[model samples]
Target: MSKKIETDNTCNTSRRNLMKGTGLAVAAMSMIPAATATQAFAQTSEWDKVFPKSDKVDHQKVPFNNRYGITLIADLYLPKNRSGQPLAALAVGGPFGAVKEQSSGLYAQTMAERGFAALAFDPSFTGESGGKPRNVASPDINTEDFSAAVDYLGLQPYIDRQRIGVIGICGWGGMALNAVAVDKRVKAVVATTMYDMTRVMSKGYNDSVTPEQRGEALEQLSHQRWADAEKNMPAYQPPYNELKGGEPQFLVDYHDYYMTPRGYHPRAVNSGNAWTQTTPLSFMNMPILTYIAEISPRPLLLIHGENAHSRYFSETAFAAAAEPKELMIIPNASHTDLYDRMDKIPFDRIADFFGQHLA
Candidate 1:
């Protein structure tokens, strides 16, 4: 068994301690109202991804139910001329508010071309997926979303369930780690340009949010629930990825990918819409990577841009996870650069990692 790291280098919050009560959070997550499995979703056949459609892979829209019974919509990608034998599969998601049509889809398609069955799904409540009071985010449900994807992939006749792996990009990277830690069926896992959404929400960027600030934020969220009760609706934030003059470079980079044509898709929450006002509440209390060390014995690979503002999230998580773990820092890449910049995204290295482990 992999023992939890006693200390974290980037932040003082001990995940070892936080994991003590994770069972309660998991139990609470199981209680979040589930929807019917037969829920119908409308999808257009037109090619609408931010990235160009790849001809080397066979792509199709698929829907699968999570344990919460939310129907997640995904695009499945398989190699065009692969053998009849069952092949290794992967479940890909993330960057949080963004949908599968953005970075995750691109990753899935590229990996499919490299001879893996890849499913890129929009996490529950986002994109074409089925969840009420839409655009809500959850540390637990989102983590479960990845495992749900694994379930779907494993059921397919063409997939070798024992050779399954996961690839989480940006914020989904954290979700991927959390899911793999619990879902041992996964043989290997990789996170690229990762962000720990819970860490960022709870502690703020770089753990800069003081304890008083955290308390104040939680208090505001608690009170906001009453207003939501009165309105019978959850309020949403203002349109995300909007840049006023003089924003930070990383924000500008995000705007470039999400708001601009470079990576925008109409259905993506981060593109032009907003998340529920209280979306941060669940994440603030639940540290998703609390049991990251438990993923050991399953190879874990974390990729991050050397200059990304969120690099510390990966570094912190890397410190917490046990061996057979590796942290790969890409030279001269920014956070968003890995989103769609094929030249900057290390697909070959990722393929090699999965190939070796899933073999």
Candidate 2:
């Protein structure tokens, strides 16, 4: 691992420092919700997505600027046969380290088939989107990514503008609600198989980590940051091996999904490398969705697989969210099952919820 980190110094330099402009500034700069900084993305015209192209929807690769001034790339899907009379539009993203070519694209394409304009976007630093320090995750910048999608949707001539909605899968589900709390432009929201990335990072799974443990974790990250400053590169942790033996069931599920043809994409972190080790530094202090109650009056729908280990994320988020919210659990779906299992995703329910609320 140390050998790889030493050898891959060029890309490793991007693991965290590229996003913040300077190594000394990452901790503070990343915490700011909006950035004045600009970045160039490596845009692609090739059809290299993980999922097969849909004949039912017309697709295009488009780019939009986020509140943070980072350019995010997205796949826009429109029903091939459009009525063209100001249709409702939706934006989709997440499962944490995933790019848009996996579950998010599937959801957007499915929604487009049901007569809504849909966009599945790569968040700030991941995928083909802009932002350097190749893998950095921020609770604040990520939440802003959703609102920027809303802003883009609102400006389209064929869209209703006022009928914008968002779906966040996995960690982004929690981010979707955070976007709604601040941007009332979003009339409805849906979060599927969600995880509050911050919650899990700070408190450990099931809120089992003690404050002392959290402090120790923070101290460890601090040392990592010092290492980052010393090496002039971010700390690195290799992703779990896709074909390794004797891993836990959930990790096996992840391996089957992201590392194989079932859902593999060249740009996904989970499909190859993991996030920058120091990326957790921001999540340690920034509690996202603290104002989830503010999302009330706006409709929210939470979906999770009944057997998913992360089901508690949706449960707690649903509990904290105000009126006009609904939670649905799929009988036997696991966390990774919802990433690509169309038959198990309950697209019908998603369509209905967005249809009614987005109307």
Candidate 3:
């Protein structure tokens, strides 16, 4: 287990400026009525757009419902010059709390540019998706979110149902693997900066949390459920850790992206309220990758940054899986670097992997 390192001077300066700025104030002031917060978060200004509209692909807003009846919203991207032929389809989601407007959409647009039809979706209960008591998480529901994406992609007119694939970023990487393990319809899978949410919830980073600590966490969540039911208020926790002076570079990198103008989205749970207090309980026991080995024969590509603190999750998953699995580590990159840093993220390798597997 890697010990939490102190934040450097540069990180401290950035964090301090960020907190003192209007961003923090806006986020804090949003804690009023839940309905108002939801509305405010849903508003996306032109300046907040992450990906420029692609002229090479046709884009449309599509909706589909999961078994949970949560209406999952997705932006479908299709190549304009498909020549009326069905192309391989890629479904993407993640970085956990992020909406499709961020990394996922970028990936979808790029993949479409590379001749694949793609759909980037907001997981159930987040972004444009419909679910009550906003900003919630569920292991089963989140896992199902990927399958719902696959379902939507498989039925698309420009997509070859048999050549469907998935790309999961950050925490969604775990969900993608879990989805492929069960769906069998996903011909290939790519997990970037993957995180096993179950492992993190149960053991903390690098398994620092002891067994007793895990039990205590579960206990607290159980009690919080009762409190939430009684109060009729949404159970929320603060962000994982505040950016303070002398924190680790990885922590600072996360803060720079998720907590700042670089990646902040009003609908993002991590950007605003913490996830549901009870969310960790589901993650604690629901090991999403236990069946990862079963995904073999179907290719799995695990990409991680060499310097990413959470790289071990992908390493461990790669070791657990069977043949036809490849692990690529990008040099000098940290966990969040792969999120949106196009130059650092090995898009060529990703394109080759999908092209080969989906062929």
lDDT of 2 by residue, 1-359 (tens): 00000112122222122112222212222222322222223678877777888899999999999987899999999999897699899999998878888889989998999999999999988888888777678999999999999989999999999889999999898888888899988998989989888877776666666676666667767777776788786655455335558644666788888888988876777776656777878886777879998987888888887667677788788778888788887776788888889888889988998898888
After superposing candidate 2 on the true structure, give the runs of residues whose Cα lies further than 4 Å from its correct spot.
1-41, 241-243
Give the best candidate by lDDT: 1
Cα error, candidate 1, residue 97 (Å): 0.7
What tens digits encode model 1's per-residue C-alpha lDDT throughout 218-262?
A: 776787788779989776666667787865577788888998889
Candidate 3 stretches greater than 4 Å from native = 1-48, 239-242
**Cα-based lDDT at residue 119, candidate 1:** 96
In model 1, the Cα lDDT at residue 227 comes to 77
Between candidates 1 and 2, name the one with more favorable lDDT.
1
Listed per model in order, the count of residue pairs whose N, CA or C atoms clash below 3 Å is 0, 2, 4
Candidate models: Cα lDDT each: 0.82, 0.78, 0.76
TM-score of 3: 0.86
| Tens digit of per-residue lDDT, candidate 3, span 249-341 | 666887788778777766676665455555566676778889999997898888887667778788899888888888887776778989888
